[model samples]
Target: MFELKIERVIDAPVAIVWQAWTLHYAEWFVPRPWTLEVIENDLRTGGRSALMMRGPDGEENSSEGVYLEVVPQQRIVSTDALKAGWVPAEPFLVRIDEFAEHAGQTRYTARARHWSAEARDQHAAMGFEPGWNAATDQLEEVVARLKRG
Candidate 1:
């Protein structure tokens, strides 16, 4: 398979969740102790999205991509296969995030589609599920705070 997926029922409205994803992205993109720095967050089709994850020990991972599609609070599709202006990029994976209203809560799904099964396996070995799960939990917390005020 070429896709890795994570789904959760977050305890917040879809609007709040969408706000967290778009406005307060760095606040919850990664688990605590591993902070994220959003270099750029153009939430539009063909716009650039760049972020840096800073580890406690000064390690950093930076990812740059272009949004392939953006549908407000409904769905987002981005890929590192091309940067801003559709420049050729060293491909990694295409990420798709979907959010839906479910009984006043948010039904969220994150999908990472790799170019090859080997790439998918490498991502799995790199702690995709647990890391993404922690990020989802963090997203829920961020949305909860947004819901408060």
Candidate 2:
């Protein structure tokens, strides 16, 4: 079981940060210039989420997953990316989002668990740092925009 976790202290309230994550921000939550469209986001426990992300190379990646747990503006645990309507994919991926408030700011942590050690190593070597960090940077921007509005 390999674990990859990244956390950032976002300069915003927890609620605003949580909204940016749960809402349809995948349309812009990537390192490259791409778009993410959340086909369906049922935010309740055992609900479903389906997203289609378009890459700069004009590639489209569609993922369908299930919400395993949700604690308001605090935490979200979901299954790995699957086919539409919660169908499991080969070499599945599970995602967890842990949110909290610290010193009046929000702490956003995203963790991913892969099915194999080789997959984990591959993701790490393939630049999960740059990819996720860049995405988080965009996340901060989204939160800032919400605060300004």
Give the candidate number with the greatest lDDT: 1
Q: Candidate 1: where is the Cα deviation over 4 Å?
A: none
Q: Write the per-residue lDDT of candidate 2 for residues 1-149, one digit (tens) a residue.
A: 78888998999889999888777366346666867787878887778877788888889987777887899999998875554465666745688889899898998999888888888888898788888888888888888888998
On TM-score, the leading prediction is 1
| Residue pair clashes in candidate 1 | none
Displacement of residue 57 (Cα, Å) in model 2 is 2.2
TM-score for each predicted model, relative to the true structure: 0.96, 0.88
43-120, model 1: which lDDT tens digit per residue?
Answer: 899999998999999999999999999999999999999999989899999999999999999999999999999999
Model 1 per-residue lDDT at 54: 96
For residue 128, model 2's alpha carbon misses the true position, in angstroms, by 1.5
TM-score of 2: 0.88
